[model samples]
Target: MPSFAQILIALGAAGGALAAPFANTTAAAVTTEQRSAAQTFTGDITYYQPGLGACGETSSDSETVVALSPAQYDGNCGKTITITKDGKTATAKVVDKCPSCASGAIDVSSTVFQSLADMSVGRTQVSWSFN
Candidate 1:
């Protein structure tokens, strides 16, 4: 028969073994979330001229390009975002970094901004999502 301390040690070892798989699975889940998680939020929207974008892309007036904050731009360059405001929605590609944008603000090209709201609005409340 095993001593009480021996039995506790064996159980602890088995528990650790069982927990190892779960720990690994949790780590993988976190990695996957980091890779392709969808983010949705409301923010301020403004428009900019079509020219040299912060992402090093030359965008045209007809191209739907958007600029995000530096933090959001880090992993989201070239991603598509759907922006909705009032009763309009438009999809635009992330093409630049908006250093002056607030945490939740996104600056889009005039074409994209017009698709969601008239340029006269200048700035508007917008809900956006990206995956």
Candidate 2:
């Protein structure tokens, strides 16, 4: 037969082992909650040239172009879009669609382009994500 002290120690060890799984599960839940709170997703796209009278004389650098599926062009004009260029991010509404876009470039306004990246040069590398 085991002594009383030995029996108590064995019970304590078994209890801890059983609690391990629950502790791990709680930790995982906390991590998932934090990730959901900090969720920020971004989409990648290209930049294209703007059309005449697009943004009312905004410079090339401050312009952006988003491809529309014909119907989405005029209907979703005021939809908000968050654009991240270089390291800066700017939020703007979808105003116009570039009819001359190459394949996957979405056109934006000159002010937005300038706020997000340097438009002085021809084109800039940008990553666009919406939330």
Candidate 3:
């Protein structure tokens, strides 16, 4: 199975967005989604280095932050979401945009990643909704 970075590169050319599901899924914290009526989304969750993001926030890797796909970014920019993985749950803030992520996928920081699984795991599947 390809690592999250590998799949990112492989799918980057396929319209600049992820279209397939990961064979190995884990959980995550940060993501972009419109908050409304408790909408829940489940998909691949991965981690990314944080910095000055789309939301104009500078976050460190140790921060509980996340990114959403481009399609979901603009509207949900400063929202908070609750992420769940393997019965472990945490809340994270939407701070950046995951250019390569799919609609339901979330890209998060190291702190949030570790809250769900070991960073070595790289990728997982998580369910998240606005908080």
Which candidate ranks first by lDDT, i.e. highest?
A: 1
TM-score of each: 0.73, 0.42, 0.70
Error of 3 at 7 (Å): 66
Candidate 1, 62-129: lDDT as tens digits: 89899997767886778898888887889999988999998779998888988888899999899888
lDDT of each: 0.86, 0.55, 0.83
Which one is best on TM-score?
A: 1
**lDDT of each residue in 38-126, candidate 2, tens digit only:** 54433334345445433343334444434332333444454555666666777755555666554334556566656765666546555
Show how many residue pairs clash in every candidate, following the order shown.
0, 13, 5
- Candidate 2 at residue 97, lDDT? 61
Clashes by residue pair, model 3 = 25-124, 25-125, 26-124, 26-125, 30-66
Q: Write one digit per residue (lDDT tens) for candidate 3, span 30-131.
A: 221123426888888999899999899899998899999775677787889999998999899999999999988999988898989998889989999877
Candidate 1 off by > 4 Å = 1-36
Report the candidate with higher lDDT, 1 versus 2: 1
Relative to the true structure, candidate 3 has a C-alpha RMSD (angstroms) of 18.4
What RMSD value applies to candidate 1? 4.5
